[model samples]
Target: MENVSVLEERKDFILYKQNGCSGNGMRCDANSVSGAVSQRACVYCGARVVLNPITDAFHIVHGPIGCASYTWDIRGSLSSGEDLYRNSFSTDLRESDIIFGGEKRLTAAIEEIATKHQPKLIFVYATCIVGVIGDDVDAVCKTMSKKYQIRVIPVKSPGFSGNKSVGYKMACNAIMELIKSEKPAKRKGVNILGDFNLAGEMWIIKDYLKRIGISVISGFTGDSNYENLLESPAATLNVVQCAGSSTYLANRMEEEMGIPFIKVSFFGIEDTTSSLIRIAEALQDEEARQKAIAFTKEETSKITPLVERYKKNLTGKKAAIYVGGGFKAISLIRQFDFLGVETVVVGTQTGKKEDYDIIESLVSKDTVILDDANPAELEKFMKEKQADILVGGVKERPLAYKLGIAFCDHNHERKHPLSGFDGMINFVKEINGSINNPVWKYMEESL
Candidate 1:
């Protein structure tokens, strides 16, 4: 809750003890301050990360090669069927193409991919260069779609358009365009939204749903394929996991298709249990609801002992959290609390007012809550708080180590699943190992 001096322009973006209680909300969902070296990604990167997980979709970045290269395999999304989404394709537009317009080159790229791969769907991303050059990507997509007799969707994601949140909306709009249909008869199933299946987390959640007698019609993008998405309209309800990326899609489906959505988080045991029960209740399935309760009880009993053992060593340690979405930050706060560790500092990239409100209520009054924080801000807060560990994405890993604080990877590129009952164990084990690692002691001794 202590106040720290920051750049004059970034003062409103950071929250601490005085302002945290003033009922003055944190500033978010806005463009990053100039020259702050903000950690937030661009609009094109956001759109690519959200849509590239569809197993069977062909993705083309209609701009320079660097845009495509940076976002290649952006999400650690595993596929059960097709691997086409893993390849980063681009028109490789050059000075000549930009000057003359890259429409023809884009058309050729789509034609080549369609001719060789014969894909069912394709997404063309417009980067800043394409936006500047006045390329009509939408018209090109329509012509190519008719020519190939396939769905060629243009993602209107220019990097200069807005921040990552805008890109999430753009990707959601593209998905809505791809899956729109005459109302289909509803079935006894749910569509999982917002989870990118990083580290096979989607598979883990699907298995739990199956055990509870609930069928998953589709995953929003993670491990989902063309067929899965095409059948999504038939689902009875939607359970949104990553609200940051998929909430807009859910809202569109509800408005256009009459499928209601409920936000759910599967990160920690507490949320996973509640979300499963809520899904069953939303479907009016009493039998499945009872099954969900039984599973929660069973899983909690099985995992609580192991977590308690780790807590013996971890209790009273403090943590700093900086993640992509508000839901993940909220879940991590609870997870750390369960382990008897206190979260002293927390921030999010795209969290809204409501998300921050929940976070504010959950953490202690002294806890620092920030939005769209840059590396300098994170380091200052973590150091001031004397955090024992920092839970964040790849971007923050080096920062944590350079400050001699233990680090945990809780982002998309992680190789381990961090959802459901199984994930609770993995998360606790990682936290215990990272915090108790011997290297920190050696560094201190040498210092």
Candidate 2:
């Protein structure tokens, strides 16, 4: 509220100073303002991104072809074995089908996918059109599940009903429903939640935990299959990496299956070490704790010297962060700090009050914090703060380049890992390369 010059209607959503605020630091967890050109994706998109990482599941969009095409292979979530999730299936509902109800089209699509692919699981996503047409998506799924003796789940996500956060909830609910009927033998390992395994990041975390004598029973969706998910309730604990999308599922599992969960982030050196220690402590395994301590000590010694070199080169540079979740934004701030980079602007599409509070505490007094920011707001604040670089997803890439600022891919589109110790090295390398590129000299001269 420190008199930041954003649009009048968006004043409540942007904050320059937290101490002077009477209530919460920034307004968040609300629908994007009308005509704000908010960067948040639709409800169906949110659900699809969260659930589309299941490697073996057949995902069918029960709407027009556009909806399916818009999010085809949306996440960079990689699979080790099956890659059937890479294919985007649609009912291809036409105007005639919309008038007569697209339930038949949806059923036919499911039947074709099941028969040809022989998939064990199928997810039918209800888009805005399906929601409007009153298609009985759930009933169709139930009938198909009975007929094929496979799990045909219905994900209720209408783009017009709510924002992306609501779609995340819908995805979690579908996951819960998927695992409800199973009763697998309990495993002594843990379930890793919220990570979509972009660039095999989940695999890196799994390796770290394995080195510390911890077993990962399954990932929430990333690189996970139907069989693995059926065993989720059997895990001893749920370790959440992306809290925005997976916290609700973890809460439900804890409430019903007595499986406790701990939120952990593995984005930077500090957070990776801390998360390893926390996970070891949560499991109450003495051997694992000692191994984790030794491994972190050795890894830090090897990585710190390399990181210090980058810190020297990146000193005094400032970065603006706009990401899908608060957890990632907070991690990026810490990561930039590791490289001696100042974070001048930060925001998220689905961050809660607690996430924003942590972010506010971490940033400098002059840092601009906003929620569900539009491109105009982002550009204004980035220029005002004089950010040298911007770390965001695909949507923000053009904006950063248009401003002649360096841009780093930190979201689903990236093919590189940025989650563990190795990922930290890759992240700094990319940041250094982009920021120090000689092309900026020409850009500056032209400007």
Candidate 3:
């Protein structure tokens, strides 16, 4: 690791080799720099990631067409029932509307869509210009809710207000408004949080919970509908998977409804086994706990041989991770460990200080830990670390290729589910395919 001078403008944004270089923890959860080409998305992107999986909600972007178009069905969250959430609706505000007021058009768009679709819930997202023009999105949503007698939620996600983490809090606030259960019936169930059910990952986890005699009352938004979200208060506990997006929601639920929450990850065999046992023990169900232990033994026996085969081929490989949140990055480090891979360089877009603390504690002393890293910083760190593979989202794939490094897609666009027993297998297969490719041999010699 090398010490690089930070620009006066970006002094608070970039950190230099914080893994073992400094006693102070890395700074995180701040607004991205103006011209840094940061991989972090806008506030609206954060809102959409958490709320767009409502299977039957009419998600209308209350701004220009670009915002709606860019986020239309962006996630791979599948629906078990209605596919209404897949469609992107926009008010399509133009230059004239921006100069004037777009509230009237927004109201009309809501009325038109509600009449045609007859959806039970609607989510209106405000964009950058909507924030600039000071549109009364909340007032319009209130009026529309009264007019249609359906829940019309307003997500105040102005692009420049803060980072994506701000948008996640805003989305949680909107959901709190929709909860109508005052005295929910107590049941032996749990609410799944943070997972967006990408490629049916939530379904896989739900099935496992069912086998352990626990019912899943609702998912945060993944494959979840309006009715399921309304029933969330009835559950006894909350099992949070993606802590970055759902921790706020879980904390609010505990405060408002008196339901406790526990953070868990099902990304690797070690995590998945522990999470199942933890969930069962939290409920004090002796039968469920025994079943969970039995389930882990069976599943591990089936998956370990496949993982061991891949581990033999992938021993001592070094990996670099750059993802949206800290939980995924932490899980990836463990997932890589199963295959004998070392995470040399790791960074996150909106990871909190606590997440960075755990990340710093887990990796080797020489590994690089950074926050809100730009493309130039990522390139420099990966090359300096001599990373064999880069595990990141779509944006970093091209950069890895240009450097003759292997790349893996661990973001929302990936069709394969990377969760539970099935996900562990997928994780190893993806790493083996990327790092052990035949073309790398030729490229190495040519370089």
Instruction: Give the Cα lDDT of each candidate.
Output: 0.91, 0.92, 0.89
Candidate 1 regions exceeding 4 Å error are: 1-3, 18-21
- Evaluated against the true structure, the overall lDDT of model 2 is 0.92
Of candidates 3 and 1, the better by lDDT: 1
The 10-residue segment with the lowest total lDDT in model 2: 17-26
Worst 10 residues of 1 by lDDT: 15-24
Off by over 4 Å in 2: 1-5, 18-23
TM-score of each: 0.98, 0.98, 0.97
* Model 2 lDDT tens row, 23-48: 46678999999989999999999999
| Runs of candidate 3 exceeding 4 Å displacement | 1-23, 180-182
Per-residue lDDT for 1-447 in model 1, tens only?
A: 336767888888877644335577788889988989898999998898999999989899999999989998867788888888889999999999988999999999999998998999999999999999999999999999999899999999999999999999999999998789645677889999998889899999999999999999889899998878889999989999998988889999999998999999998989999999999999999999999999999999999999899899999999999998999999999999988999999999999988988888888867889899999999999988899999999999999999999999998988899999999999999999999999999999989
Give the clashing pairs for model 2: none
